[model samples]
Target: MESYTGKSIFQKVAVGRIFYYEKNENIVKRNRIEETEGEIKRFEAAKLVALGQLDRIYQKALKEVGEDNAAVFEVHKMMMEDEDYLESIHSMVREQKVNAEYAVAMTGDNFAKMFSQMDDEYMKARAADVKDISERLVSVLLGNGTDMGALKEPVILVADDLAPSETVQLDKSKILAFVTRYGSSNSHTAILARTMNIPAVIGVDISKEWNGKMAAVDGYTGTVYIEPDFDCMERMKNRIAEDEKKRQLMQELKGKETVTKAGRKIHLYANIGNVADTVSALQNDAEGIGLFRSEFLYLEAKDFPSEEEQFQAYKTVAESMGGKKVIIRTLDIGADKQVDYFNLDKEDNPAMGYRAIRICLSQPEIFRTQLRAILRASSFGNISIMFPMIISVKEVREAKRILEEVKEELKEKEVPYQDVETGIMIETPAAVFESGELAKEVDFFSIGTNDLTQYTLAIDRQNPKLDHIYDPHHPAVLKAIKMVVDNAHEHGAWVGICGELGADLTLTKTFVEMGLDELSVSPSFVLPVRNEICNL
Candidate 1:
């Protein structure tokens, strides 16, 4: 047996046969069509057929993954129906006198490559959208649609990587696990694997020699054993059983309140980047959404997201929480997370540079649009607005002034929106020192330990060489947390911690004693954190 390791999207175990997913290698590049009219007709006909297939996929996705996720297929349909997109294809067919399949392939490659070349991560992802539609059109033109069929049997799907469209077309029932050679933990495949509760490991470049081999996939350890011996198989089976037992026990904690040994109740919440994550958040019985990273909206869009678009997404997530407190953090851009469209100048020191609330305050119109959306979404359920990377009273006041402007705009339009509370992230050392005064200005205080630790320790968490010095549990870090907790309570504000530190089991007791009212963590950690709280 040969064992390989990578990174797991979620922790699960699966023993299955390795099935290499093959891509279509044969595609006609160019074919002369004497009848120009016939070629254009063929392109139009192929589009209609693609739409029919997309409609079925959309319906299935809606029923299987929910509306927000199902919108992937809907997006493909819109792209196919777009006048500019169709014009490009039509021009290729008419001017170049090429066949419909060739025109589609060429156009798709051009557009996809264009998006792929962009600096923004989300815009670069749109390359997948172009390829998805183009592939469907070309397949229709060629009279062959491989994406239409189901898998013959269950297997651990092996691929170099998976596109968003390819990932969605998969049959979850037959997918035992997903093994990829290239993909980040935040890739579409990784997110889908977590949402569907499937085992997945990425960045492992497995050779074809392992195909058809019986494998034991361990997501926790990121190990894949190919053609394992009887002894190895037995050990893996036992490990799987043990993990399954632990999972079953964790399931029992769902919907139960997190109470400490002294009967102190604490709210346990989930942190999410997008709306689709609401499923996993709720499944783990999160009391609410503690940190909604709203930058995803701007990141995913081709340009700055419109107010209505932001409003719909926020409203959907809020409704999904079903009146549970949903704290949406405003755009936390800059530092490692940069937006190309924002045209931010290159910075020598980005971590403490212009970011988050600084960007919003500098650009009032941009900030106003987001505030309007959040206010509009407030009507659906319990929603609160949070500002990150905050350090001063002046910045907080200016931000609130623009928020008030948006509220007035909504009122003039007679929009139905609930009165939403506002808060600031206690991340900077400046904020921590002035926590008492800062707490008095906001409805609540959320200690963002991720940045707070980085800024306080003067260590770039991203720098691997500084791993030894950058301590999350440093004495200074603990002292800052205690100070923030004490100040928040003293000034009539609740305190919560929404960072990697919140999920640390060792710190749960310390936080409880320090008077933290809430702990926000990832979905899978919700139960473990709650269970730790109960034990304490």
Candidate 2:
């Protein structure tokens, strides 16, 4: 019985035969083509094919996982169609007289390297995005295809790493689980595995000879047992049964109201990044969407998302929610969520530097464009606009002024829209202290506990070295949350928490006792949280 231990990304269990996926690194040798135009045409043709395949994958993922998760393909499609990216590929093919695959490989490497050097976390992560798209294009150019049709049984897949494109292309029905040799908690494979509710272990190395061997993967302990004895297999089967039983029980709690024992009903909502997430949000029985990270549209786009582009995305999600509240937070790009096209200046300390509301306030037209889109989408269903990183009442008033101006413009242009409620995120210590004054300026307050905790504790949440120091339940962070909740109530404004802390089951009772009116977490947490509230 061969055994290996690695990092467990999610605690779950699965047992099945293993299928190793060692992707052959296709090396496209430099070949001088006779016709530049022909190579360009070939590249364009491959691009079209890749886009079509991505669109199909996007649709499948939308139904299987949800919209926000499916949006990864949308980002890929946009990247493939990006003018700058296309120009680089075209120039390479024409000038270098190289084959389509070589041109794409070279261009992708150049762009990815540029992104990898950026200080922002999101920008740095985009290096992976470029690589994914490039590999897709190359596969299309080479006309390579996946042939797993002969496998009549489901199996746990072991791969070096699974790119987003490859992950989406996988036959989920045949996938028992994912065991990768290399990946981190935030890697695309880990993210997809969690989205699909599949158990996963990463950063483990096993002999290549283990392929096709029966194995048991223990996600909780991060162990992979190859050719386990019959006794070990029995234990895995029992664990799977226990997990299934818990899932069945969870399903029974789906329609249960999230009312406390004291008869206080707190709204349970979902935080989504895109339209795709609404499907899962609804499936998990989320009453509404509390935090829509509007920056996703900006990040997915090659440049600034036009008003109409933003309007379509917002409208799709709003209409899909069937009039349930959807609070769209206006572009929050900065401090780890930077977009390359924005050309935002590098800062010594991005977290405290120009970000969120500061960028929106400085770039009024950008703010106006998003406000116009959100307002226009409000006509389709229940919608509200929220601003992030707001540390002052002055910024709230200024944002409202611009919003009112956009309303008038839309009114004059005869564009119909709902009178969308506006709100601010109480994320900073300054906002906590000034909550009373700030609450009066907005319709509601949504405590962004991720930033709130970080700011209150003076720690960067993204730093792996600071993991031990970061505590969301710290007295200072809790005090800030209680202050925001209390002051908002005092000002006749309700408060909701739409951050990581909102999803912490251990603190659910404390939050409910503190008078938080709503808790917005990820889709998967809605039912579990609802169950917790009922127990309270």
Candidate 3:
């Protein structure tokens, strides 16, 4: 028996035989081509084929993982049509008189290197994307298929790493879990695994020799046991049964009120990134959407999304909730969620630098565009707007002033819009102190514990070295949350927590004791949280 440990992506236990995934290795050799134009033509044809493949995969992923996750394929499709990428391939083929495959390979390597060198972690992850697309194009040009082939039975899939395209294309039902030798929690593959609710562990030292052997994956502990002994297998079986029982119990709690034994109800809402995620939210019986990350529309787009585009997305999610409250957070871009079109200057400490509400206030035009969209969408269903990273009362007033101006514009134009409820995210320590005055300006306050903890601890949450001390459960952070809740209540403004800590079951009781009105988390967590609240 052999056991290895790595980082867990999802907390679930699985017992299965090991099925080592073998990715098709495309080896492109530089070949002198007499006709450069013909090579370019060939590349263009292969590009079309790749685009078609991506479209199919995108649609499939849309059904499987929802829009935000599926949007990676759309990005891949966009990459296929990127002017610079095409030109690079064409220029290489024409100037160097190389084969299409060689030109594509070289262009991919160069572009990937450029992205990999970027300071932004999000952009750096694009390196894998470039490589994935390049390999796809090369495979198409080579007259080969890039399918992972069907599996006869479910097995624990072990691989070096998986590209987003490859991961989505696999037969998901046949995959009991994923054990990768190399992957990051931020990688698209890891994100997909989480969305699919699959048990996964990354950065494991896996061996191909374990293929076809009985194995158990302890996702909670990030341990993989290959050909485990009887005692280990028995323990794994018991754990799996317990996990299954808990899932069944959670399912039974669906449609039940998230009320404590003493009859105090907590509105258990789901947080979503895009419209399609509303399906998961409703499926999990979320009372409402507490945090609709509106910035994803801008992040996913190549340029600033038009007001109409934003309206349609917001409208869809609002209508889908069927009058359930959808608190859409206004564009919280900058810092970690950087967009190229924003043209933000590089900052030494982006977390504390210009971001979120600061960007919205600095560029009111952008803020107005989003507010107009949200107001327009408000007429369709229950929709509330929230500004993120607010620290002062003045900023809240300025934001509300702009909202009123947009409302008047809509009134003048006789465009239909409802009076939307307004709120702000309590993320900074300053917000905690100013919560009394700030609460007077808004209908609600949603404690963004993720940022609050980061700021309170003065720890860079993104820095792996600080992981040891990046405690969201810190007493100071909890006190800040409590302060915000008390201040908001004093002004008759309800408060909720809509951060990673909200999903922490250990703190669920603590939050209830703090008199939190709501707890918003990912769709997968809604039922479990409700169960916890109900039992409380």
Candidate 4:
């Protein structure tokens, strides 16, 4: 191999390393059947040490960052201590008489092989789970930590996979982009990465082939280019300059009203999860908090949070916004995001079955607790309650009934409260059809286009086979959105959209044309969206 040249003409090569966890682990050659008991014990000892290290890391994060900020580390801690995973490792060691290293190495190799062979993109990305666990194990075993100091300059981080803890600890300013060998655009890491407004690429293959190769990744276009010819690099440079110019202009527009270049008024808002997210929203110059998904209150707790707990969480977000409108969706949990506390009954078609309002109706106590919490929080700042997945006027009436009941209870307890505006999310076609009727009862309406598209098209957005049918721009989806907006407006209720479709530049004008009063999207989209709105 005196003269070896192996390269592809691809524009961008993903970066990763060929990590071999099997190295130094006494793996008897497959052909040799030597005793592996001692090696197995050593592997088990390594596993124990790794798990213990995870606990220490979790504690360190908890001490460095508050409990809420260290949620990712907490999740990792739970995963490491999960009985099933621990039992699996112990069982493998006992059954095979091999050490923990061999078990983990074989598990990683097998999973990588299985995922690599899978045709489904979503499932294939799960191979990153294997990579994640293996990476942590390797990191603990060899103590070969990739010092964060090496990335002194602001540049993109290209890797095979990134744990949530890693993402949380990353210095956002130094990271311009995040490209991974395996991930979906909808994955949690991608979600957080998007919030940081750093360009990211996921599901990239052959990342290890590009080690030490300088490349530029365009997260917007999902493109990566290795050492490119001057022409391409020049083009990229010009694009970057243009982008910077546009960004500077947008920065100047911050704190100004979201009015179109034509002087037409449009509302710009942030869709946030918790109090921490409101910080990003305000930073992006969001006029208001349009969609405060209430699921986080449920997800981050060991049990159902008490009404007081929920109230404080809601109040924190509302008070943080300082009178900015915050539309809190009521307990939008079921089906897709089942909570440990609220265990939904398995359904043949969960997407169409008991979810959101359906689940709330069956468990009014839970719904009442949340309603009570929202009302109490309302005393602190501007907050509106939006009932998710309401398909009929009946659900609206029932929710309002529960609200009044909570009001009476609060009054009886002499607790301070505020009168909150009630709204419903028009996400199902049935709900869109009845928007006029629902709007008459509700104070406002928010179109949840994500679910509307899936329900109208009868396609599971997460299903790989039907992902194409999950188009939000389908004419039918547009019609549903238009109908809901018109109905809500005709009924003298403000209508807005809190969906991925809202912030997309391609559809922003279409939404404007459709008469969407407010568009709530991820904070990262705020600047670009505002720029687009100004030019509109």
Model 4, which residues run further than 4 Å from truth?
1-174, 181-184, 227-237, 261-263, 345-348
TM-score of 3: 0.76
Best by lDDT: 3
Ranked by TM-score, the better of candidates 1 and 3 is: 3
lDDT of candidate 1 at residue 96, scale 0 to 100? 85
lDDT of 3 by residue, 1-536 (tens): 88999989889989999888764568888899998898888888677667756765775586579888988998998898899999999999999999999999999999999999999999999999999999999987875543444578988989887654466457767888999987666455565676667789988999889889999999999999998899999998999899889999999999899999999999999999888789999999999999999977986565799999999999999999999999999999976666657878756578999999999899999999999999999999999999999989899999999999999999999999988889999999999999999988999999998889889999877554566687888899999999999999999999999987898899999999999999999898999899888999
Candidate 1 per-residue C-alpha lDDT over 1-536 given as tens digits, one digit per residue, 9 for 90 to 100: 88899888777888999887654543767888789888898677667657756865675576579888988887887888878788888998889889988888888889999999999999999999999899888876765533524567788888877655455456677888989997666456776776566789987968877778899888888888888889988987898899888888899988778998889999999989898789889889999999999988976554799999999999999999999999999999987665556878656577878889998888878988899899999999999999999888888888888888888888899998899989999999999999988888899988888788988999877553565587889999999999999998999999999987898888999999999999998787899898899888
The TM-score between candidate 1 and the true structure equals 0.72
Q: After superposing candidate 1 on the true structure, give the runs of residues whose Cα lies further than 4 Å from its correct spot.
A: 5-11, 19-26, 29-90, 93-101, 104-208, 219-222, 338-340, 345-350, 459-471
Task: Give the residue spans of candidate 3 off by over 4 A.
Answer: 7-9, 17-24, 27-175, 178-196, 206-214, 229-231
RMSD in Å for all candidates:
10.1, 9.4, 9.2, 11.8
Cα lDDT, model 1, residue 232: 82
Candidates' TM-scores? 0.72, 0.76, 0.76, 0.71
Error of 3 at 424 (Å): 0.8
Tell me which of candidates 2 and 4 scores higher on TM-score: 2
lDDT of 2 by residue, 1-536 (tens): 98999888777899999988764556677889989998888787667657756765775586579888988888998899889999998988888788889989998999999999999998999999999999988876765543343457999888876655456457777888889886666566775676567889987895678789999999889999999999989989999999899888888888778898888999999999778889989999999999999987886665788999999999999999999999999989987665657777656578999899899999898999999999999999999999999999999999999999999999999999998888999899999999999988888999998889889899876554575677888998998888888999999899999987898899999999899999999888898899899988
